[model samples]
Target: MRSKTAKLISWTTGGFLLVLAAFRAPAEVTYFLLSTRLVGSALGSCVLPLTKPEDIAEARREMTLDQPPLIPLVRITAGADGINRDYLAPGKPSWTWHVTGFVGFVEGVPEILESTPALVERRQGGWFHDSSGAATVAFTGYKPVAELTREQIFFASAQLTANGMDLHWVDLGANYLYTVETSSSFSPANWMPAPGGSWPIAGTNWVDIATPLSGPRFYRVKAELKSP
Candidate 1:
């Protein structure tokens, strides 16, 4: 992005420098200016179509109930050469522009996640400038991860991580009455009540416990949400 900016600044300054450098050679100076203009024209032509608000709405409508947590994809390009290309608008974008001039139109500016691009006049391939470009639109799809149930209950299923084992359960209106048990052994004698309190609300909740350093650790959750 900085490179693109530098190239853009060069566009403003390069001509002046060329004049100074070619004072002894007037013919070369004229050639240089002409080359710069041609390259700039090419860079101006490589613009990609911007994403439209209607497009995003249509995309969301096309998704099924099974699809959720849509993610958007934005494209960024440094030049017509297509060598320095990247994406914008992932789970989040670095910058966002809003369109407030028009109502019932694209409601907001597209988010930009790629580096800033600048048109760079290059002598390669017979004098051309790089087309620095950004996308003003986005398309969405189901997020990378599958949709998760907001509420569900499990007996012994727990995910172990470096910090601890995360246990989860859905409070089915059982007044959120619940208890947890953990043990290093499978023997009932080794099982004892794990100290914990009720969740603030009767829904899905989670708890984390330190990972056992020795033998395999086990956990169990029993919950009861009272009927209304």
Candidate 2:
């Protein structure tokens, strides 16, 4: 009957190309060994062995140190679904990069971000200390002409002399809200620096302003002072 209807239409197009190659999934190689020293200096090393997964996006290792060696600051391609969303699938395997430093009570991985202490008073510099002491003050009457979406708001509004302090102990302390993406073009594929440009206040003045919308956005106010 016409060669059995052309072999049942070529076995239904070879079972739809074997179910689209079994739903194509492969790509998961994670490794991040970024060494850093100076918290007491001396005791930072890197080893080599079994490294081949396309050479980890162009690997380069070195760390002999009296000073110098904390390379490979970029390879980030996480999986199991998270962080930069798995680079691009294809039979994943191969990852190793160790960064070490923690003498006296060694605990690993549990610091998304932690560094608190912010206090800087200036309208005339009458109490300065911001190099991690934290303090960059400047606020001008509610300036958000428009566009203010809210994923978390409360940028800043300071007035704490510290002596008797009370506002529930200055709202408990530790603040972070960053936002900087001034129209884009700072390179390294935009490594933060363009939200009116000028950054170094990182003790918490609420800086966590991620953007993707469009047009006009400016923010400023950093006051990270706590330690009572």
Candidate 3:
């Protein structure tokens, strides 16, 4: 009977050992890191008005901005999950962001950061005129501060003045491509710059008419983002 009891105890001990062996520790992969059903998460976030002024300057220079119109930016902080760590895994962490997409018709602005590493390229386009053929100004912008960045830019119609044709606008600033084309008739080829030259205003508006536009003429402002 004692022998029979000893054999039963041995069998029970072996079964317990097999159960322990079946339940091994999980791997480092995040897939199985969480419980069967997830509850809370560790998502990353960020704020605007960047800490680095140089980065802001780079962004402004890329857009060829010489005036202040209150730019907006979306700052991002990488998730501090397993991703934040270096190759060593236990090393200190650094943040990064991947910038892409349109700034209103523009494709993929600056790509600031990436885990594997990348680059930020800003390409400003040339004169974009409306073929619809109406009283409208050409559109060109490189304000990468925020997506869909809107600014009040209008090219007022040339008015007849006592001295000459006075050209002014309600709101316009840092227009590097402020080229005014005037024509006696409504023809593309006939349209040319004012008597002096194309006045590309870098900043400010309301310039006194030096060259008198004596007779009736057509005026259209072409704003183009020069190639950077």
On TM-score, the leading prediction is 3
Candidate 1 structure quality by residue, lDDT tens digits, 70-127:
3333343223321111122132111122111111212233443211222222222221
Clashing pairs in 3: none
Q: TM-score per candidate, in order?
A: 0.27, 0.15, 0.28
Q: How many residue pairs clash in each candidate?
A: 10, 14, 0
Residues 1-228 of candidate 3 have per-residue lDDT tens digits of 010000000011322211000111122211100010112222221112222445545544544444532222222222222122122122222224222211222233343311121111111111112342111111122233321111111213334356555554322212234555555553333765556654654332333355332433445454444445
Which scores greater on TM-score, model 2 or model 3?
Answer: 3
Clashing pairs in 1: 51-137, 97-109, 98-109, 173-225, 173-226, 174-224, 174-225, 174-226, 175-225, 175-226
RMSD of each: 26.6, 25.1, 34.4
Off by over 4 Å in 3: 1-157, 170-175, 187-189, 203-215
| Candidate 2 regions with alpha-carbon error over 4 angstroms | 1-27, 40-60, 63-67, 70-228
Can you write out model 2's per-residue Cα lDDT over 1-228, one digit (the tens) per residue?
A: 010000000011322211000111122332333223333222222211113454433322222224332223211111111111111123221122111211111122223211111111011133222343222222111011111111111112212232311111012122322222222331223333434335433332322234223332222222233323
Residue 51 C-alpha lDDT in model 3: 27
Ranking by lDDT: 1, 3, 2
Model 1 spans with C-alpha error above 4 angstroms:
1-157, 195-203, 225-228
Against the reference, the lDDT scores of all candidates come to 0.29, 0.22, 0.28
